[model samples]
Target: MSGARYWRHQDQRYNMAGNECGVCGSRFFPGKTMCPNCHRRSVGKMKKFYFNGNGKIITYTIIHEGSLQYRNQVPYLLAIIELEEGDKVLGQIVDCEASDLAMGKKVEMVFRKLGEQGKSGTIQYGYKFILK
Candidate 1:
């Protein structure tokens, strides 16, 4: 059986996210149904692409309150990363000291299991960032 089109479009290899526009030759991350520039819903998707997984921190915060899974991972880093592809994404940071957090700092992504999808479902694994 075929999976959801969005699931197939995301590059599991690198956690790259992009959506193409039918009205304009533009792309966006964190996939959506409509184009922001032209306000059109007829978006086009080309072949899947992998991101470089290296970005600079745009903005971030240390999370103290979160889900059960993140309870012990408090003071965790969640940041808006500006990718090399020119897309900004929100994701977690790992494998580095919290003191290293800084705007415009270089980061590299590491794929890790986010958590179980509710219960008795998929174990979602995605990319996370670490100081470079």
Candidate 2:
């Protein structure tokens, strides 16, 4: 990602910041300018929401191979986590083995390094989940 774009999303990358529909109490991650449920009425009712980063694994996969940027992390765990607020998020699971995970297993977010842009470029950081 470009430097400007990365910085623009710092809040979301670092804080699990999202948005909620003031009209229906519905929430979304990565935030939304309008509520899908309330539509027109939600145009001006979206409010910033911060997730607590506590969730449960809905499903998961073990990566035997990864892309070039993440090849070193092959065999890592990735899962769709249902946050306590009800929004499901896809993130990497760290600090445990595959045998330790299962559907409905509780997990918590932790900040960690994602990767670096290049040898001397900016480093990327984001949230990863760990078994609670």
Q: What value does the lDDT take at residue 131 in candidate 1?
A: 90
Give the alpha carbon lDDT tens digit for every residue of 36-120 in model 2: 8899999988988888889999999999989886799989999999999857889999999999999999999877778878665
In angstroms, give how far residue 109 of model 2 lies from its true place.
Answer: 1.3
User: Over all chains combined, what TM-score does candidate 2 have?
Assistant: 0.84
Best by TM-score: 2
In model 1, the worst 10-residue window by lDDT is 1-10
Q: Please list the C-alpha lDDT of all candidates, in the order they appear.
A: 0.72, 0.86
Could you tell me every candidate's TM-score relative to the true structure? 0.72, 0.84
Model 1: CA > 4 A from native = 1-11, 45-48, 117-122
- List residue ranges in candidate 2 displaced over 4 A: 1-14
